[model samples]
Target: MIHLLRNLALVSIVLIAAGCDRIGAPVRVDDAWANATPAGATVAAVYMKITTKDADTLLSATTTVADHIEMHTNSEQNGMMQMRPLSNVPLEAGEPFTFAPGGAHFMLVELRQPLTAGLRFPMTLQFQHAPAQTVQVQVVELGSR
Candidate 1:
């Protein structure tokens, strides 16, 4: 009986630890920023670095500054830079997904207000394997890196 009880306790502890692992955030965002839009322009691009402990997908994003946001990638085709929409952004475990100029970015469309330098806005990112996270995005100069 004593040995059976010890085994039961060990099983319970393992189960508890497994549950705890699912309780915290699995991803982290860093260096989030956006570019200031031109006067009267309704579109702006946002960049960030996202690191995840496990494989995950960025499902969507929302912000009050735009009617909608889309994941986009800029590529040079035929000597012209073009932007294309992405359905979702995949994050690899222990790898940082860097969103920067001339690469992957979030395109904000139908802006509610013009994006000006030195302003900050809130962006909520939803992920497939983690809870939604809100991060403040700083609007920087037009040519900021």
Candidate 2:
């Protein structure tokens, strides 16, 4: 009886640990923000951390804030930072992918209008293996961060 009880307890612990992997939903966004920029002739980048519980890919994104939204990454070109567009953002289960300045980021180009503080914009993100999600992001003025 003692041995049977011990085995059952061990099995319960293993089941709980395995369940953790599937408990995380498809995708989650954290610390999403567009870098502060000047009034005119300014380009901005949005940063965030994307987490996926299952293998997925970021297909595309759309928003009215910019004429074009592209996934980009900064690479060293002759020791200088060179930004290049990515084919797609890859996500792995139980992994966090961060999009920050000087790294993997989102290029919000051709600003339709200047982004001012206290302004929030609607943006949508589409995933290859998950449903499209929309998020509201606020604009931070220069000198704010």
Can you write out model 1's per-residue Cα lDDT over 71-115, one digit (the tens) per residue?
999999999999999999989987899989899999998999998
Model 1's TM-score against the true structure: 0.85
User: lDDT score, residue 83, model 2?
Assistant: 79
Q: Residue 131 deviation, candidate 1, in Å?
A: 0.7
lDDT of 2: 0.82
| Minimal lDDT window, size 10, model 2 | 35-44
Give candidate 2 regions above 4 Å deviation. Answer: 1-24
Pairs with steric clashes in candidate 1 = none
Q: Pick the candidate with the highest TM-score.
A: 1
Residue-level lDDT of model 2, residues 44-66, one tens digit each, is 78878888778899988888889
- Error (Å) of candidate 2 at residue 118 is 2.1
Q: Which stretches of candidate 1 lie over 4 Å from their true place?
A: 1-24
